[model samples]
Target: MQPSIMLLLLLPLLLFSAPSISTAQDFDFFYFVLQWPGSYCDTKQSCCYPTAGKPAADFGIHGLWPNYADGSYPSNCDSGNAYDASQIGDLMGSMRSKWPSLACPSGDGSTFWRHEWEKHGTCSESVLDQHAYFQAALRLRSQVNLLQILQNAGIRPDGGFYSVRGISSAIRSGIGFEPGVECNVDDAGNRQLYQVYVCVDATGKRLIECPVLPTSKCSSRVEFPPF
Candidate 1:
């Protein structure tokens, strides 16, 4: 065949064979992780309140990470899909309130959010856009009153300790699924409640049974420190 004919035959294949950003959909589920601010601040490393002021003494969102069923996960799936604050302008208030960052030298939660978006959120772009990604998390956060759930079950955060089984059981009873409880040490090196990981479906909505739970370093009885 002539060079021109050969080029024409390969043009369609070349265009279609390009890698796509939507392969991010292949992940099995999302780990909707929420961290307790009191436990976070109680650590020796400490934490700083956001510039806007302190967040509520409740569970703050960590990230809605995509993960495989076999304990593997994907991240930074699409460099092209950069984090843009403007895209989620309408949901700014919800984001700041529910997903506040407790990290030191905190300006606003934007830096934390951008990092989450770039690292984890980008992996879920197949099912959610930039706006939907944040909105889904905010909505999910509202649905689960974690502190209320634990308190209602007599698991108050008054520097008291409770069995890890008890904590997970109460949350599971309230939400109808098992929860992954992670603990961190306080200034004095006592293990305290830190983060709670709940599984959400791939759609980023609806609570589901965790295909696999995150490894929690909690002692048999972990402290739930007050803020």
Candidate 2:
């Protein structure tokens, strides 16, 4: 075979074998964080419901954060790619249901959603656009069913304190992977359950082992305050 022909034949193999390169903003996984409304309200003194009114007795979506395998993450990746509430029209209903803002002076959840989108969603642009990013979080929330899992484990949010082991076990049993549990101290100095963060693959489609286990100040027993 001619040298030139040999080189041409090997070109495709060389290209295929080369390692894929990614930019700094690229991420490897997602942290789907769900916050407990009761805990948030208890800590914040007051809570504001969306214009649609108070959310149901369920964990609200804090954000779907993009994380790297190295335990680092990117934020505000694209300053130009600002959040636009109008783009997420169809998702508004679900967002209100599963991801309502419990911050003060709510009514419009857009501000909170915008912050999440701009800060975290932009970092995931390589895999998900604005709409898909929000939708993925909603879908993950529905799929995880954290409330149902805890309830089935006799861990209702009735202002009862639950063992961190029990809480983690319930989630692991329900979702097939251990999740990170976080807590906060209310005004009364009670250690209350705050958030549950489950790691998802970069595609935001499937759960994966967390690259770095989440650390929490939550003790062996954490309160599951009622909303």
Candidate 3:
């Protein structure tokens, strides 16, 4: 075969064997909510317990109602706090600077939470909102150097909560990214907390679901990579 012809055939094989390139979603993760502690499913697309990756999992994307009681779960979250964009932005910036690999967006976590808030359109909002906001951002957080963000935010990566109904429904629907809980264990018994799960697309654009825990908070630490 001609030298040029031989090169062309080899090039195709080399390209085929090359590993796939990483995208935003590879660094980004998503979490769908099955239900809030007190809030009920408001729409048919919404439900108390839903599959991991379905749209119905977004039912409790926002904070839960404080006054409403759902069977056993009581709303202990502070539902009276106002949204603070500045503080959230500051924290996000800090996280971004610390972890340039994951490339966290610069802005207030409250802004995204605001969208969730608008989705819910309920009066329930509080310090708990701050907790949820920060945790959601951490879902995409990388750069093992930024341990302080977890510490300051009070997020236990090793502890998280999931809904029984939501897990079961996810098992039945079998259409979404089967939801699961993750945690981060710190020194000894101290652990970082991550209450929200934020799922993203390849470019990190689509936010499929953003669930809120009814009463329990989960951890967000990644252990395999040894962070």
Q: 14 in model 2: Cα distance from truth in Å? A: 9.6
lDDT of 3 at 119: 37
Per-residue alpha-carbon lDDT of model 3 for 1-227, expressed as tens digits? 99999999899888876765422121122233322211222222222222112221111232322222121322223344544555466564433332112112323234535544343322223222454544443443431112333234332222343333333233323333333333333344433222223333322224443233233334332221111
Please give the lDDT score for candidate 3. Answer: 0.33
Colliding pairs, model 1? none
Q: In candidate 2, what are the lDDT values of residues 132-152, reduced to their tens digit?
A: 999899899879899999999
Better of 2 and 3 by TM-score: 2
List the global CA lDDT of all models: 0.92, 0.89, 0.33
Indicate the residue-level lDDT of 60 in model 2: 87
Where is the poorest 10-residue window by lDDT in model 3? 50-59
Q: Can you write out model 1's per-residue Cα lDDT over 1-227, one digit (the tens) per residue?
A: 99999999999888887675335458999999999999999977899999989998889999999999999999899999999999999998888889999898977899999999999999898899989999999988998889999999999989998999999999999999999999999999899999999999999998999999989998999999998
TM-score to native of every candidate shown: 0.89, 0.90, 0.22
- In model 2, pairs of residues that clash are none
- Candidate 2, residue 214: Cα displacement in angstroms equals 1.6
- Model 3 bad stretches (over 4 Å): 1-79, 93-111, 115-133, 136-227
